[model samples]
Target: MRNSLRFKVALFFSVLTIALLLAQALGVRALAEAQEERLIAALIRDDMTNVLKGYQANPALLPPFDVRMNGYVSGADRESVALPATVRNLPFGTHEIIIDEREIHVAIAPMGTAGTARLYRVYDFNIYEKHFKEVINALMGGTGIFALLTIWLSFGLSGLLVRQVAGLARQVKTLRLGESAPIQPGKYDETELAGLVEAFNDYHQRMAGMIAREKAFTGNVSHELRTPLTTIKTSCELLEQDAAIRGKSRARLQQIERAADNMRELANALLMLAREDSACEVEPVAMAKMIETALTPFADRLAQKGLQTTIDIDGDLHVMANRPALAIVLSNLVDNAVRHTDRGGLHFRYAEGWLSIEDTGPGIPAHAIPHVFDRFYQAGSPDASPAGVGIGLSIVRKLCERYGWPIEIGSEPGQGTRVSLRLPAASRT
Candidate 1:
């Protein structure tokens, strides 16, 4: 029963009431007894002296038989106590007697002859006893009623306080992490509880800001994709209008084919971003060995452009990654580096779980650096003579982000550029 708050509160107040009532009861009993004793002593002593003085002044006015003066005495059964041989009357030393058939304290003394000059002192406690009993009954009843009222109020007040706290806690439990919830106000005083409620409202507003940013990121990507798609569709329609399949005009058809391929590649890159949870199968690939294999396809182009290639690859550095993803990312970076370099030389390094592509090329401009990662955003205009879609960095960014690897881009315009890839160091189970 003590586990419940109402029971505990009620018990506490009940115990407090009992203690106060007990102290009051003891004080009342002692005070009533003392006051009665003092009152009885004063009345009995004064009467004993006065009656003895009256008897001393008149000696012949006494009765022969022993009797109570001016009043008849009675026993406990409301009958008369037999008069003794001597009138052991009032004013005697403290003793017992019958008065009105009730036994009571009495004292007697004589001032003149044996029968005359008598006096009495009486301390009958009957009246005080009756008065004390009535007071006891009234006090016990009043104290009991007060104790009951206090217990009821304690349970009601404490239960109300506990109920409000429990309700607020249940509501807080329903709130979700990273998601905002509507605040339902609970019963509370205009105190510390108000501050806590305002804090929750502030947190809900901050969550709204994060939700808005995620929405904007998605909207921007969709707007960027629309432009390149329209350009590819128009170029394809232009090629289909002509019927000649031979001569220098064939390059027009080839250009259309290349644009279509580029658009398909860009679409696939966007698909990769959309499906980040798509799992890919993997196997070991030696860095120095795979770069040698991949660079073979671009050799002819390098030769035609009167360019030189330098490969300074260390021993076989094994890395685990999806072959297709690594091929697209590495090929795109290398191709872009080679295309933009006027010196026509490509350099490579494979060291410490990383592969770097460095080219002796006129590097990217400084002002365009920040926007390089934006989709379909190419750096340098026709004046600096840079080519290709601006999405190579976007692909690299998405692939590196999805794979949880690190990518670094560093360039000095008119000097050279370096693109570094750091693969995740695999953990052993």
Candidate 2:
């Protein structure tokens, strides 16, 4: 009922094969039975004629008489036979009698005597039951040969079709996301499967065009936003330069300006990460230097909170990655850590090719670690609320993936939290 081609074909062919079998079986059986019936009928007719002639020649043959012939014939077959008799009296040229438990025709000719019938004779082909068995075996044997050929043809056709279908599946799997146009599959003319490939390719083309347009729009929005941020930051610096507003208001204005800049940077990161095809220039960024630059701006905040900052990074341990991305990652982390810790210290360390940041504030709960890097996923903690857009860690994870870096998170409730930045070393490459 589903109308799928393979199912329909299988069902139709199987039924056809069965039909062919049944027809052959019935046809052969009917033909053989007719042939045997005619064969028995002709023999009975001749034998009945001969016996009637012999009885007519002898007028002494009268009532309560019986006649028999040799039970076996040795030439064509070794089958044993039994002569048959009619239960009722007959007057005619032919009569029907049982030939070895099978109904067969016999001929009879009687002369003289009106109600009694003076002369009567019967002859039967008595091996009809044995002949029936032979015919059945022969019909069944022919059916078996035809059935085998049907199965072979069915398998051959299915194999040919399945091979081409499997090839199409393989090609579809390796299709790339960055191609400007969808793949045009190899054509198989005048086939329903070929039409299906064309339909899929048409849909793919439309989807690719839509994705490209979205990327262009997002990139344009990010660039447009950066221009206004730069102007506002410059205006803030000029406003802070005035001697009149220097004491308190000028500082507050600068902070407002800095926050705007951070927002602009965050927007840019979102744009770049939105498209998986986005590419960036990789550079060797000194792990220690990058951490120092990010932490320097937070130094005053740490000092005010009476929280110690420790760094155990070596001289020039480096990672290959986009510098702007690295800056955003560390900026968000250091900012979040400063906001979270009131008294306890924060430590930054690098070992092998991994940079780790650990904070003494109440760490993330174990259950929350799975979703900690997800966008807009923030546990109901004080740090998650303050200085958080919930997109920072998500951005960090994306950048780490672009850099071929693996990120690890370790946290325990009421203890501490540690985030590790693992980079593939130059030697590994």
Candidate 3:
């Protein structure tokens, strides 16, 4: 909770408000105490003056005041007239004293023409002390109530602010890689929040435009290149049929044909990948035919390396998928297998909705296996063959991810590598 911005903002304001309240309470209590003291002193002096005048006129007529106050007259033969030693010898002035564990405020003045006669008026200090305490308690109680209200208000306001920020964050997170639509500006009363939403909307528009342009360019280039590639492939096939071409020259023409076929497959894959949607028609595809078509372009390479190929799938087994997309996936996988194996055989198997390709080549190192599907990541060492640009496996991984298929690769140092592509149950059906 402490990491949350709303919590921090509320806490900050709450502490500040409490501190201010405490300071104000202390200042007000001090001022009240000073005023109370002055008022008590004035009342005491006035009462003493009135009693002295009445005593001079008729001493018996001046009855005792409230029990909280007492009047003492020196030279009078009365118990109340006998003052404590602490105040008995004091001069005519106001004094504070404690007698019999009771605090008193005293006012002394001359009583009569006799030099020895004097008046002492005393007021109980407990009354003023109790009232001051009550005032302070009330102030503190009010401060506490106000503090709670302030904290609640702070949390409410901060929540409103943080909610706007969180909404913006969620919108940005939902902007996927292929999303072409721009984000809409959110409605907010706060100027800063509205400005932030506006800025994000602008950025979203620019990014969407850039992605659309990139996809268009890729599609156009791939489409334009396909016509010429088909022409070259057809010309190469025609030349291969000529009786005059033979030996090394015929092999060169065959290589050109294989290269052209690979190029066409790559172009088709690029066009499919560049499209924003995967709405191609799904149809039942024969596993045997798919494998045969994928392997045709690699026949020259497999023959050159003397690598034996094996297929262990039922002839009637079929998978449901978009034909062109699945073609790219299978071709890339086959091409990767053919490029790596220098000797021994390549094997394919289908069981339990999984299609696996096993190759008996120098196995990928354990450290390199994790990054083998990354774009342009060479598995072991630099290959002298021009075929290993390291993007075939990456494209295969991308297609599998798009179709929600799980792909796994297992390899040991000296033993060979096996790649398994787990198809959906619906695909197998």
On TM-score, the leading prediction is 3
**Candidate 3 lDDT for residue 139:** 93
lDDT of 1 at 31: 85
lDDT values of the candidates?
0.66, 0.69, 0.77
Q: By summed lDDT, which 10 consecutive residues of candidate 1 come out lowest?
A: 70-79
Task: Tell me each candidate's TM-score.
Answer: 0.41, 0.56, 0.57
lDDT tens digits, residues 185-265, model 1?
555664566677678767876866765675576566656775676677677667667776656676566566556655655
Model 3 residue 88 distance off true place after TM-score fit, in angstroms: 33
Candidate 3 C-alpha lDDT tens digits along 265-301: 7777767777757735567778777888888878878
Name model 3 segments beyond 4 Å from true.
Answer: 1-159, 162-187, 279-289, 299-306, 313-323, 350-354, 365-371, 374-385, 400-406, 427-429
Error of 2 at 352 (Å): 4.6
Error of 3 at 375 (Å): 4.1
How do all the candidates rank in terms of lDDT, highest first? 3, 2, 1
Clashes of 2: 3
lDDT of 2 by residue, 1-429 (tens): 465444555556766996889897988788878887787667666665565455568645433433332111111134333443333344454556565565544344444444333333334344556767876987788788777777677656765666666566766787765643454555554377688788878777777778889878887887788888888888887887788886578668867876886777688777767756444567777777888898887776788788888889766577777777788788888876777677698999887778889999778888889998898888766554455667788888888787677889898887778888886444324
Evaluation by TM-score, superior candidate among 1 and 3? 3
